[model samples]
Target: MKIRSVLSAAVLAVAATFTSAQAFAQDTFTLKMAETWGPNFPIFGDTTKNFAKSVETMSNGRLKIRIDSANKHKAPLGVFDMVKAGQYDMGHSASYYWKGKVPETLFFTSMPFGMNAMEQYAWFYHGGGMELMQEVYGAHNMLSFPGGNTGVQMGGWFREEIKSLDDLKGLKMRIPGFAGEVFAEVGVNPTNIAPGELYTALERNTIDAVEWVGPALDLRLGFQQIADYYYTGWHEPATELQFLINKKVWEKLPADLKEILRVAMRTASYDMLVLSQHANAEAWANIKKDYPNVQIKQFPQDIFQAMYDANKKLLKEASASNEQAARIVKSQQDYLAQSRAYTDISERAYLNTMGTVE
Candidate 1:
């Protein structure tokens, strides 16, 4: 009788252990996101929040994302390091911010005369840019995806027009990233001013000029009131926003979760570009109506060509000593070669025929 009782007890214990294991396997998880921008800033913070929402809905409660904007839990500049160290799961920031850490990270974000937002999307998603991007970021214990792109930005607001390359000489301009290096080469003194202080710097004449986003964001920020001239030929071309995920966190995610993240990022990226396009159009019209003194001018062809040529030379010089930079330059040039053929034939031709309708 005693032996039979002991055998039955052992059988019940084995069944309970199996059930516990099954329950543990079925449990859900959460993802944390961080960003270096303020919350609710259109084209910047909005897309990140959109991503958080989309991931939650797609996962059907199995996964939830908590987004913390700049300075919420850590300093904005530390976002990359924090995410890399696994202090946070993910982050949203401009690729230019980390030029000091990884000089080549700039190519993934923007080039001096690089591809436009649309062409960049094509190159990154379908064109092999994504593969090389992985290689670069992998070195820093990160996984990245295209979060958003600010489509062609304004030439930047200035107290005076830049008629000749000489005009750039000795001018203190507020810009960031690799663009700063190029501007410096052209004789402009580049200064890094936080967003909060940008307006005061321009208003008080502390900085000669500042380049923010397009009219949509610029007008909203009240730069139109402070500066006399707003130029159209954006030197920064297209600013690609990045989503950085901690390498370990990325690797640990189940395959399904990883797929969800990639798809969500792509969706957010597309939506951001579209949003910026419409917003800029409306803002431009409204600005012309409201601010009559704000002179908007296209860059002269001669000046544009000179800057473009200088950009090429600067790129070659910068990459000469750095192999990774060389790889990025090669990839960018190759992708541009392949993409420009189509762009020139289709988009550029159509725009030329239409001649800036609206």
Candidate 2:
């Protein structure tokens, strides 16, 4: 009887160990997130790292994210395709980067003379814009979250000041997405070059001008060093960055883990926008101190107006031809109308009154 009892106890112990091992195996997850930006860039890289950290911490080590920055795994522009193909679980990118896949993707990135960062966020979160954007991504077998926003971008860095319409003619610029379309309309040839090639392109006269994120990232990339003139009038009033994930991978996440990812991505998105705005403000001041020779000019009113007109026309034309484009634009336009109506009464008035104070 004593020998039988001891054997039973050992059998129970082995069964318990097997159950424990199974539980531990179910608890850990490893995911890959990809980005085109170098790991050293301030907001993009740092934000990506924070996302991974947030997921790991929120999961209490149950999930781990490995960020593949720059060309660590694949070329940056292939982020969306890789995520869609399940090569990478997620991607951080500008929706416009994949504009070739879906011409309408540019609208999700920016609209010239369109909403600012805060208003765009409001439209996405509360105005149903997010759902509409997801609809576009859904066709690509992906889902996207608003990952970041560069409040208002500089028109671009030009080799020379653009003082008149004539000045823009024959200028070859490294601009992308819809703004590139607008530039083309205005007689500037726009080339879409990868971030890694921008500096060398600008240096070698491969491109006469280039527009990048803003003072923060652009200055760091040394664009200001190669280009003499910086023009601003919101070529891209607000540019939204996106995080895309394979739909299958997203669906497979445990419910709790999915919620955590959503919350973490949104938090990181908001934080990145606010941080970039502040950093750009500081960088502007620093640029003046260090590069006094740099010419900073508000784009001439006529030039700004012309470009705005071209962009508006392009938007109207694109929406009419593409059903998906029309849907996203209608959603965005409706939100903008409602938002502007409310803000005109409060925000616009406050700003006008404040301006008169001094």
Candidate 3:
């Protein structure tokens, strides 16, 4: 009697385990994503691909993500809208790109002369940045996560070397976000151009200059062939991209799947920064050897001062306009002030010391 009872209890335990496994297996889901980049467009596109693959792998086929690039979607800049409308379950793009519609979105991306990648990441995860971002996106019926980082972007590709502030005046450049507003304040006509149109726009003289991204992506787009001068970056120091999901779609996801997506997005975002460092370093070396006509330049000190002043002015104006913008701006400013002090003594000091070596 005792042996029979033991065997029956063991069989019941196995049956329960099998039933649980079956339930999980039957709850399979597939999500659709749209990206701003064209198909397989280097680091930016690679971020999305890596993210989708990681989600599927981690979930062990219980969850799958299907990515649609700009080529298929036919809207490179409409990612926020598509995801919000639930036309796509998710979107991979930059947050600042939507600043015209949501002014607070600009702060979530890199601010001009703001924190670097490391500092910005700290602010996002540790500081109040994530909550603030959710507050902004939640209103739009979407959830936003950090998609990727491009480190520091090049200021732009210029046809001719800019000697002074006068050179920037009346110059039509493809620059976006609050940086564009700052540029506009300093007399630059800042315009937002889709990534695919950048080469043609610059080649055809539709725009005088373009600030697409750093070398990894700019090189892929063949910007070096037509533009003679590449300037150092000041506008977008960290340039964190965004992964957006419809709030409704996210709410419908199982808790386990939501956590999986979160982990995948965070890992993918960090990986892009690493990949960018590797690819940009290699591309820079190649540029030096092959692109003889491409001269690297820096904006004059006066130009920097003017734009800095413009940035301050715009921040004040934006804060004055909206309560939420005020909170975000204040939060960012306070965080930057606290974080950058350490950065100056640590990373900046280390870099300065290294500059003297041989």
Whole-structure CA lDDT of model 2: 0.84
Q: How close is candidate 3 to the true structure, as a TM-score?
A: 0.90
Clashes of each: 0, 0, 0
Q: Which TM-score value belongs to model 2?
A: 0.89
Per-residue lDDT of 233-257 in model 1, one digit per residue for the tens?
A: 5466777889999888877777887
lDDT for each residue of candidate 3 in 307-348, tens digit (9 for 90 to 100)? 999999988998997999999988888999999999999999
Each candidate structure's TM-score, on Cα atoms with residue i matched to residue i, is 0.91, 0.89, 0.90
Once fitted onto the true fold, the runs of candidate 2 whose alpha carbons sit more than 4 angstroms away are: 1-26, 193-206, 226-228, 344-358
lDDT-best of 1 and 3: 3
Give per-residue lDDT, candidate 2, residue 348.
Answer: 84
Native-to-model Cα distance after best TM-score fit, residue 307 in candidate 3, in Å: 0.2
Give residue 207's lDDT in candidate 1 (0 to 100): 95
Runs in model 1 deviating more than 4 A are 1-25, 356-358
lDDT of 2 by residue, 241-267 (tens): 899988998888888888999999999
Order the candidates by lDDT, highest first. Answer: 3, 2, 1
